[model samples]
Target: MNIVVGVTGGIAAYKTVQLVRLLVRDGHDVHVVPTDDALRFVGAPTWEAISRNPVTTSVHDDVAQVRHVALGQAADVVVVAPATANTIAKIAVGLAGDLLGTTLLATRAPVLVAPAMHTEMWQHAATRANIATLRARGVRIVGPDSGRLTGADSGPGRMSEPETIHREVSRMLAAGADLDGTRVVVSAGGTREPIDPVRFIGNRSSGRQGIAIALAAADRGADVTLVAAHVEDAQLDAAHAHPAIRVETAGTAAELGERMRALAGSADVIVMAAAVADYRVADVSDHKLAKEDGAPVLSLVENDDILAGLAGARRDGQTIVGFAAEMPTDHETVLERGIRKRRRKGVDLLAVNEVGWEAGFERAENAVALIGSDDQVVAEATGSKREVADALLDAIVALRSRP
Candidate 1:
């Protein structure tokens, strides 16, 4: 594999040296492209020594050879380590005068960005938009983890470790990213059933799990569409920043049902992670009802079950995975809800978890039991949302491979 490692001017420039060394050690054809500003932080000597190839800061170095064009054409993957806010902005706006940016523009190969900047810079609106643009272009983002960054600040603006970046880079090369080649539609967040214009019934879903699954699918090389509804602020921010995902928002189960039905014929996988309302107001008032009265005098109607519909109406070979936020007491309760949900929904698998005491929804950590239609525990794993997503996807792929 040929890798074009782009380094920028962050304190993380030093880490890129180790990153290049690892890629070389792993037997990848490594090419180092560092910005002029990056050269100040870590000179060409280091990159040259690590990559064993002459490093150039600009396209002027080899005018006849057209280095940017050649490098981009040959790369299997292009990884930008410690992508500073400046570079991210430039790339976002398609400013390609620089060697690295120009080569990035020229490549058909997958691009992965590892961002590192000040916390304030990371949170800026413009920076946020730039990240979103990059993600929508199918660029993979690794991390700016929570820790000490340049100066006396610390947050999520520190670049991920070289080892982690290397692993992700290798994974991208292995994925052979099937973006635009295969179709996948994933529903996320909780749907709101309108009782009035001002308020409606909603669930305690943050959509973190759904975002994790979308990101994980991208990492595994699939074209994924995320149907996001009633998403939380954080999840919305992250989803907005992801450039690769096509997002559609819905406020009611009926709206989501319509969207699902439209995509039903062509999808390869449908993950129903949205916590849709079981009942909706039969008579939706045009105006918010004045606070007066007993029982709220609300009439109810059954909302369509989006998961079962997807499982039943989807074209052949389309896999269905459902999630349930079961507020359970004991392990038996967990098993019962999981088994019942799996069978009742006719889904290939059900991801069941307890959410009353912070076992799943709105929490940082979650545990889940994957129940297959056969009522057997195919796989069980627990940790952060990312870890649980991995377990869930593993189970999905396994279930899919079974005869």
Candidate 2:
């Protein structure tokens, strides 16, 4: 594989050296493209010696070969390590002031960036918006892990370790279309039950995990139907662009159920990842309730169990999967609750994750345990949502492969 490692100006540039080493050790043809500022931190001689490929930071260098575009055209993947906020902003807007920028613009391959900056910069609204834009365009982001920084600071601005980036790059390269010819249906986001014209009841599901699952399946060559409820346009961007994924929208639990049922029959695998409300207001006001009429008596009714209903109506040979977002009680573990729910729903698999005020919902990362039909824990994964999605898919692929 041809790998392009774009090193940006940051104190963490030292770490990217090991990342390049790992890729070269794995027998990949590595080309190092460093920014002029990056060379100040890690000299060109070292990169050249480690990569065994002549290193240059200029589009003007080797213009005869059009090396700037040539490298990207030949790359299977492009990785940017210690990606400073400046570089991120540049990439977000397609700037080509330098060799790295031109190469990035030239590549059709998957681009992965590992950000490293101060906590304040990482949390800045500008940086956040830039990251979102990149994600919307299908650029893979690894991490600016929470930890010690260059100074007496410790937060989520440290670049992920080199080994971690290497692992992610390898996974990207090894990804295969194993799910080709398979049909998958996934429900995502939190359903909303209307209270009035002005307000509604909803959860803090950003739909990141479910979107990740759909993206993973599509990447593996599956034809997917994604039923999304209340997911933001930004959150649905990649899915909408995926050729293999057909997206549908729903506003409430009932509506989501209706959509899922309509799509379930033709699916080889059905995953219910939406956070459906267990109950909804019995009465929905046609107009906003007045302050004078505030504190009106309200009644709640239990919602239909969408997952269970789907499982019960599943076609032959179809696999049904459910998600359990449990806040485990004092007497029961998350696993126990997950197992119980799996049996209750009659799902072939259940992915259980503990959620609370600060954990699980609306977060970029997730930790999930996969419970199989045999009532045993099939797999446990804790990482970015995309990683957990792939882990669960691994189990699903394995389960279907069994005679």
Candidate 3:
């Protein structure tokens, strides 16, 4: 695959050299296209030497070859690492004076931009609006992670690491051919039930499990969509594509339920990892219920069971996995309880985890067991959410392999 690495003026611009090296080592034909300002950060000789291809900064450099046009036409992927505020704004509005801009304008190849700037520049409404426009046009944006910036700053707006950028590009390129283009949806975080407009019932789910599953799926070359509920959003892995992971957020069981059921037909696998509310106040007031009212009677109604509905209503060839968090117990009890829940959910697999004061839900690390049909413990793993996700995916592939 031919990849064009576009470098812009930013502190992290230096990292693109290493990014180009990685792409070259991975058997990709790498072409370097640096902005005039970027050349100030890293010399043309270094880029040319690393890429083993001539590096250029202008569309007018080679009239015969038409440098900008050829690079765009030849590229399978065009990535702009350390895309400065200026560069992002320029591309967002469709200005094509420079080499990178011309290539982006000229080629329909996938464009991935890894933005790097101060937090102020990144959070500015102008930048935000620009990013939204680019995304709407199907252009990929990687990251400006919340970490150490150019100096004594680090909230957000730092370029994602080079490896991540490279990975996202490769994944997008490999998508249809990889995983045979399997569509997978993962739900994460606990859902909230409104008590009134102000007060609501919710759990302590942190969404780590769902993010782990999404990342793990992407790593294994699966096309993953994350349905994130309550809790703050985490940073996405840039290699799969920037803002690498796609996210859809919902806050209530009713909201998330509608969202999940809508995705059932097209999805090959639906991992129900969210912690949904069982009961919701039937009559939620628009205003906050006054504390002076002396504890009003709050009648509750059962929320829709998303996983069971999917299990019962799934289209042909759909696979579903449900997660059940239980109180702590010995291995024997875990197996027994897990198998029972697996059957009760009517899902192909039920992943059981021990949770209470000291287990799953919002916790960084978790130990889990995978219960499949026939009430069997198909797999068990304990560690980071990423590790558990890998184990779960493995069990899924195993299940698919059998008759």
Top model number, TM-score: 2
Window of ten residues with lowest summed lDDT in model 1: 174-183
**115-176, model 1: which lDDT tens digit per residue?**
99999999999998898777644577888899998888889889999999999988667655
lDDT of each: 0.82, 0.91, 0.81
Model 2: residues >4 Å from true position, as ranges?
8-31, 37-74, 81-96, 105-168, 283-294
What digit string (tens of lDDT, one per residue) describes model 3 on residues 1-403? Answer: 8888889998798888889999989998898889999999999999999999988888778869988788888877889998999999999899999888888887656678899999999999999888876764446788878898988988899899988998888775764133445678989888999888788898988877877777657555567778888757333333234233567888899999999988776789899988999999999998888889888899999988888899999787788999988774655576678787788789999989988776676555678988888787888888657658867887887787678
lDDT of 1 at 1: 85
| Clashes per candidate, residues 3 or more apart or on different chains | 5, 0, 8
lDDT of 2 by residue, 213-332 (tens): 998888777899999998999889879988889999999999998999989879999989999988888999998988898686768899999999999998888999999999989999
Residue pairs of candidate 2 with colliding backbone atoms: none
Q: Between candidates 1 and 3, which one is better according to TM-score?
A: 1
> With candidate 2 superimposed using the best TM-score fit, by how many Å does residue 368's alpha carbon deviate from the native?
2.2
| Best first by lDDT, ranked | 2, 1, 3
